[model samples]
Target: MAVAVKKLKSTSFHGHKEWFTEVNSIGQLHPNLIKLIGYCLEVENQFLVYEFMPKGSLENHLFKRGPQGPQSLSWEIRIKVAIGAARGLCFLHEAKPHAIYLDFKASNILLDAEFNAKISDYGPSKAAAARKYVATGRLTAKNDVYSFGVVLLELLSGRRAIDRKKICTEQILVNWAKPFLGDKKQLFRIMDKNLKGQYPQKGAYTVATLALKCLSTEAKFRPKMAEVLATLEQLVNPKMTHFVI
Candidate 1:
């Protein structure tokens, strides 16, 4: 088993101590979360040890080519990964104090050997501490839902959320794909070309539709993480539709 050691510079120790405490408390207990093995906080050294993910982050798999060659995650694997990450976020949202992930993005999602997804870098302790300091803080679960929608877009379209390489509207993945979300005829145009027409059109469209709801301009309009999980489960296994939401 591999382990990842993240070291914080001495200059930033005090700044990140709260985040470290938060991870130690909440991250270790969640299976779908990256386990925080241990930490070291000596006189001038600070480091966090976590369970290593052999496959690295979903961001790397989605946007960057591997050393050997280009690799694409199959539609099935993509759905599975999305569901796993959703479940993790759901757990965080439903925690005792209702944790809100401020930094939810593809790069923060790690994949194990079998490509099981785990949500990482969510500093629940920090979130809890922040509420005490900022009475007007607007951190909410809906923010995470929006980020999840962006990840879903990445899975479907194989593009980065913000890619400068593409020009104009195409530079932003959401803007580039938004127009096609509602049009079945145009949906195919935005899909990852690596899929090579092998994905189930119905499933792809279903996820795209969900992604749109998650990316709603108004936070209140976004579906709850639990609802998102239910819909995704149904997408993966049509038989699961019988399970009441």
Candidate 2:
């Protein structure tokens, strides 16, 4: 089995030790979370070993090129990744005391050979959720739901969350996409062009609407990860009639 070793700064000995212990405690709790395999906490270097994801991170798939990741993901694969990520976050939220994954972004969502997505860098929430968590000095599971929305938007649009290369209006993905997300007629305008009109319109609309809900400024307005999972399942299997949020 392939393995990946991550190197952390050598100075933060106590921090690295805590992270090492935490990984051992939680890494194996779910299939969708990245599995930590080993570590090296030597005096000069710190390392974390994990199962090597052949497909790499979703960010690479969506934005970068060369050895970083795969070619543009197909519509079906994007939905599959989103569901897998939701499962990981749901597992965290269900913990006795929520193990909120602070970071929920495309780069942290790693994929394996079968295109199954697994979440990495568990304690780093960014974008809007990051702002809320830092501003209020409070972290909640709903914060994770917001970050998930950003990644979902990235998957749908095949765009970076913050692309400095783009014009000012398009640099911040959430801002640019929100206006179109809830409008059925405008939805296609923000969709990934790589999909080539192949995705199901109704399913796409459902996903877009769900994403918009997650992006709601009010933390309480976001759907729980379990509820989000239920919605995505319907897209995976149209016969699923039950929707719970």
Candidate 3:
């Protein structure tokens, strides 16, 4: 297995060290979490080591399709990746004392050889230790939920969260897609055309609804990570005939 080393500058050493320590203690136990193999903290040097992911971040696969051709992620694999990442978030939010992943984004979700998604860059418990210090309301699990919803949008549309290259009103992925989420016909219009009409229509609509819920303007309306996981589980289960909401 390969290893990823994150070296911190001397100026940011102390804060990063504390963050590493927090993750080392609380994040290593989960299967879906990137294992903190070890760390180095010498006088002026600081570094964090983690298991290297072969397929790289979900962001790469989702938006960075190279000059070769269109390499879009299939609907089935996208759902699988979503479920795995959600499980990691569920574990963190349900842990004793509860941990908030303040920086949950597409770049933080890595993929293994089989394209199995694993959450990385959770930093430390101290990252969101103070609720009042957060710029967005409170540092709570719902914050992560909202970020996860953005990632879900990325998966569905294969678009960047913020694409300045696009024209105005279409630059922000969520804002451009939000208006279509409630309507099934409009939802299909926003889906990745690379998918080429191969995905399950009903399942896609279900996930679109879930993503909208996760992106709720009010945090209270966002489903808990556990609830999100359950919904994803049902979406991906082959035997699931009927889905609720």
Candidate 4:
């Protein structure tokens, strides 16, 4: 069942058409990605019919505060989400024809009623690819890994990507976090206070360490998306086989 539909932007109508063509070319059946049921071009409308997510974006879940407030996503669930997203990224990166996810952030991850994550914003993702080597290019598996790292940090620290007071210029969360993540002794200082010491310390440490690797300053240093998936799988299933990153 598709949820709300919005009109396409004037600047994006042409790009949207191109996106639709590319999506149709790929033929959607990816489990981790959102499915586009149909589109209407006659009306100059670009609507993507997608499964409804009652809980909305992961960004809201992590940052929003209300009566229903951003629930403290459990360590188990966070790890699950990490693996799920990694699976999605692996599919995108290694699958045929090689489609690259341009922008994958907490905001684009949608949660179904069951809280299973589905990566959305698929078709238009190509625009992200075209810009890859360009000065303005933003799409790359490494870039996606960077975004994923931010989400991972959010999971561990229960903090937003940017915290203003800690350092200058609204304090970039990743930079402030690097030194701490590298040091096992300084690890606890960055853990989410809300986690209440509930997570397995070593497991949490492993995850935080992985997140740092994903956010490496040199894109070449970041582990491949497949490796990331394997790592998270190892964290969850102790007996599962994995290669060292």
Candidate 5:
């Protein structure tokens, strides 16, 4: 099996110590979370080895660019990846000490040969929140929920979280998509154009609503990872209605 090796430029960087701490904090393993094969801690450099995700990141597939042009992902595949990534986050949130994935983004989500999503580049939350987190001194699982909401928006619209390349409204996905998520008539306007009208309309609306719920400004309003996973499961399994976001 092929493996991906990550090279950290300097041992002096603060993140290097945190990386070790995060690796040690992990207790049990989940299928959706990328497995850390091993690590080398040298005075000059640090390296982390993980299972290679041949399909690469969800970010590349979501954003269209380069000479090859748009490599659109099917609706079915998008749901599959979203659910898988959610499962990984849910697992982390339910751990003994419980972990918070501070940096949850499309780029951190990886895919195997079969398009199975595996979350990578995870660590324990910093004592202080990052830019995405709402509370600086107190970090919580809800912060991850907010970031997940942003990613869900990316999946639905086929855009970046913050793309300076685009014109005003199009630059930031959350700002641009929030208005449309609640409006049934306008929801389809945000659907990934690459889908080409082939995805299920009802499922699209459901996912949009879920994304909106996840993005709620009040941390208390954001559903737990387990609830997030349950809502997402409803997309493919329409029978799921009890916890429909």
Candidate 6:
């Protein structure tokens, strides 16, 4: 019933034609992706009907204020959400020839009635798994992993990926939290205080370790999506007898 309607006419005729075609070809995405039920492409008008996410975007939940989104999320719920997002990314990375989600950010992740995460906004940049990174000349998967790492850090600290006030410089979340990630002795300072020391210390260590791995300066050192998913699974069910040794 919910529809996303947008103007079909781009600034130029060329732009409009390109977008019109692009939207049409982006076929069935993963279930974890916000379901695109259908679309209508008429002259000068384009509309996409998506399964409405009553809970709304993860951005509002994690970063915004007021009645729309709460100030904090429970550690359990946060880990669950992280797992769903990871599963979605894993599907993309392992798809035939591979699918890449270049824009993997809090804003792009949506939540359904049960607070389940679903990735959205599958644009051209995300369609190809082998796209070259502009700066490092690596594959796009690394860039997506970097973005996901930033989201993980945000979830852990209950802070934005880039916070001007809390950060001493322009280094952002990773730079600000790097010390805490490596030094478990100072872990308490970096974790979201809302948890009130309720999280399992072992699980916390696992998550912190994964966050550091994802933030590794060398892209090659970052764990694959499959590895990330396994770690998150362990965090949620620590008694499952799977240790990341």
- Cα lDDT, all candidates: 0.84, 0.82, 0.84, 0.73, 0.81, 0.73
**Rank ordering of all candidates by TM-score, starting from the highest:** 1, 3, 2, 5, 4, 6
Residue 114 lDDT in model 1?
93
> What's model 5's lDDT at 140?
83
Q: In candidate 1, what are the lDDT values of residues 1-245, reduced to their tens digit? A: 57999897887555556666677778767778998887788856687789999999998988888887667898888998999999899998888777778778989999999999998877655466546644565656788899999999999999999999998879999988998897877898888888777678778889999999999999899999999999998886654322110
lDDT of 6 at 209: 84
Between candidates 1 and 4, name the one with more favorable lDDT.
Answer: 1
TM-score each candidate: 0.89, 0.87, 0.89, 0.83, 0.86, 0.82
Off by over 4 Å in 2: 13-21, 67-70, 123-137, 238-245
- The true-versus-predicted C-alpha distance at residue 90 of model 2, in Å, is 0.6
Question: Distance (Å) between predicted and true CA of 72, model 4?
Answer: 1.8
**Predicted candidate 2 versus true structure: per-residue lDDT over 167-236, tens digit per residue:** 9999999999999998988888998887777787778889999999999999889999999999998898
lDDT by residue for model 3 over 1-245, one digit each (tens)?
A: 67999887777555555666677776667878898888877857688789989899988888886798766888889999999999998998887656688788989999998988898877554455534456565567788899999999999998899999999999999999999998986787788877887788788888999999999999999999999999999887675343222
Q: Which stretches of candidate 4 lie over 4 Å from their true place?
A: 15-27, 42-44, 124-128, 131-140, 165-170, 238-245
lDDT score, candidate 1, position 181: 90
Q: What lDDT does candidate 4 reach at residue 89? A: 73
Worst 10 residues of 3 by lDDT: 236-245
Error of 6 at 210 (Å): 0.2
TM-score of decoy 5: 0.86
Q: Residue by residue across 26-48, what tens digits does model 4's lDDT show? A: 43656677666566665455655
Q: lDDT of model 2 at residue 191?
A: 88
